[model samples]
Target: MSVQNRTPSWPGEQLCNSCFYTAMRTHGVCPRCGHDGVLPGRANRTDPKPVCLTCASIPEDYRCRTCAAEGQIYRGGRCARCALRDDLTALIVDGAADPATMSTIVEILCGVERPESILTWKRSPKVRSLLSSLSSGEIPLSHDGLDAVSQRTQEVSHLRSLFEHHGLLPHRDEYLARFESWLTAKLDTIAQPAIRAPVEQFATWHHLRRLRGNSTPGHASERSMLSAKQQVTASDRDDQIPHLAARHPPSHRS
Candidate 1:
């Protein structure tokens, strides 16, 4: 009788469905692949380095260690190259990346996913070039960081539009209320010297300027009218005293 070779099915012989590298043995886990829990065959390849998903050309080691991504990487691990590409699309509806990298930083910031990306991009050569061009006034702000500034301006415009639609155009009480809440939260961090002064200064200046501009000609006229009436009353009182003296006559006139 010829004996047929049979594959043994053990308690831990399960394989990952995605990558067939790691085998689930007695521990029911593929030591070779950490992702066997999700997919049975998923395995980590022995490749020295992996390639970034967005930019397959770049080595994985060159990408962000956290997200395994690279280039102008955002908080969510977006690659800088991808961000610059997106920004270029946003800035030039025609899809031109003139001045090459200026708009790149702006676009990344305009659709900013991670706050940390701002600092990272700032330190990047592309961002430095953009800033240098801006400082020298060589590049127009409209064309330079236009995307980022435009995004903020657009947001404000959008909010204004929504407010107008809801009959809240002139009514900023809700916005003020929200602003106050935000201010309170920010002020609560007063212990941090870096944050306190600038926030307070800006808030103070904004409120003061707004209040100063809020007075209308009609309100000013009303105030003036009230002042004039008060002056007339004072004059009338003075005349009354003279009249009373004449009426009483100089009782002791002798």
Candidate 2:
């Protein structure tokens, strides 16, 4: 989580060195100084209990104001986890145009094992933009609707997974669907009718046909779809099309 704006983890919490060690340190009523705070070390060799850091000649206080929990203070004396929950809840309620539509996201985000990690993700510009689109109904809360927002592929895929996991969206072959959309857009980019026509025919009759045939009841494997897409994309290239024509040249027989 950023000091300015807490967000996602690549794999774990992005805590600073101090905060990490401090969080792991013991905190309780000090036996020596009788002060309720972070425990430092024994006052003497024979001491039976731990003492406050100050009594042991070390001094630092990291306590939550609201919960009295000992940890890294996030904001207004609250711990990072607590602050994360509050922030996420506020964002969901305030940003969502329709609270009912966003209920699943809110529930999942709030109940994460590490709110700090999610907070880090929320701080991302792409994530914020996606959330804005979702909140304003710019992107409909459906699989096909999400398919239309194609640019942010990674973020969209993550959101799709979350929605599917929570039963908000029905599971489908996301890779196949993405390839179909990509093919349409890719074909549209070809201005030459000759090139476009041949490319479209090849994509539809060759790659897509085989892919559809191979797909089982559940979603097709990502590897299979990726291979098909690569072949179709390769065929769309100017040089590759000439080769395609050479291999499958039109026959004129008597």
Candidate 3:
């Protein structure tokens, strides 16, 4: 009865987004339940020719105008994927960056499990900011470029992980990168080279090297990587010396 929070599934009825998606995902007779179909708004459950909402549609307007595919229409009579691709192309090609150079990003985002999800994510201000920088060439399309962004750590990390996952960027240990960056900043605060060098050596050799050795290439878990950072941080604070010494014997000491 309440269509305010629902989607138009039939002429006079509206379904929630999820239900609308499910209802519109297929048309014609449903293979799973052998239910005969009817026009989207012309049948009822009690009718002699009952309509299966799961496989019903408006024959004249239920398809994507661009691709002629069935499913939930996004805008311009295009499906969500088509619309997402168009929007991404527009956003990503908004600057000096060549359209050809942004094809991969567009393709990757379009190929997500649900194009609708990317469309939703694109609405975030932070996401738009990152994309704007990328489009304008302020941020190079490289790990180093993402690395140089000292602000928006969470957003950068998320986008970097997405890029790495999609093979758009070379795969590397994300946590390891964070630790190395943390170590650099941590060392810069120590004016005395004597103190800084040993701390760096201890962190790199004692914790980082071992973390790398134990890592499964680009597949290191966040917990394991964070644990390594915690170890390095603990070493810096000298809060747990015995543990550090136990791990770093004289023969293998930093």
Candidate 4:
């Protein structure tokens, strides 16, 4: 049973850093003089957590917004793990990051002095893909994945700087088109000639060519294996005349 359920008419009260107290007030506002503009919870993490309205400590309602968004823990207010601590909290009103890996990513972003530079960097295909994967929960916390993300972040930053120098930045579509063209050219370069041809037909062609070159008259062993019952028309013999003449030289050199 909850406090509201236990006491039907009891005014709603929240967990306080001082003690269990009840008072009518708006969000982040308390009757206590010391708790001006302070809410009823503590920050267990860098995100946000139930904190004492007075001292901004915990044991109150709500979890850290950051950890919830990242799907991590709900310990307290902002910690070291959050990547976009302010940005995420502002956007989702919430937002750990994998410390070792994400810290590296943060360092990459930190190198960008301009805000627009960061925004433009996100337009890159590799960076966009990485963020999309993270949002969709497709990314794993493996070292390789984090390393790729870190590397792309630096690359995106460089690209953004280069674009800004020219005049303006390109959109995601432009980046995507260029990537697709590059990928296609690379694939074509590495592709085998037989890749587009039908396997069975190509194999048959190869076998016929091999037979034409290897079938000669000198080997009596292979000649004995020829089908005795087969009917050979004049056209077949005509085909053999050139080969037969080549195998045996004329009595006198022509």
lDDT per residue as tens, model 4, 37-120: 434343333644333344443323333355432111213442123433443222222233333434334444534443334544
Give the per-residue lDDT of model 2 (tens digit) for 63-117: 6776777655667667766676676556665767897766557767756665566
lDDT of 3: 0.67
TM-scores of all candidate predictions against the true structure: 0.19, 0.62, 0.74, 0.21
**Per-residue lDDT of 10 in model 2:** 14
Error of 4 at 201 (Å): 22
Q: Is candidate 3 or candidate 4 better by TM-score?
A: 3
Clashes of 2: 6
Model 3 worst lDDT window (10 residues): 1-10
Best first by TM-score, ranked? 3, 2, 4, 1
Query: Candidate 1 regions off by >4 Å?
Result: 1-101, 114-254
Candidate 3 off by > 4 Å: 1-6, 9-18, 26-60, 94-96, 150-154, 221-224, 236-254
Q: What is the per-residue lDDT of model 1 for residues 63-137, given as tens digits with 9 covering 90 to 100?
A: 433444322333234444354444444433233334444443344344444434444545456545545554344
Q: How many clashing residue pairs appear in each of the predictions shown?
A: 12, 6, 0, 21
- Whose TM-score is higher: candidate 1's or candidate 4's? 4
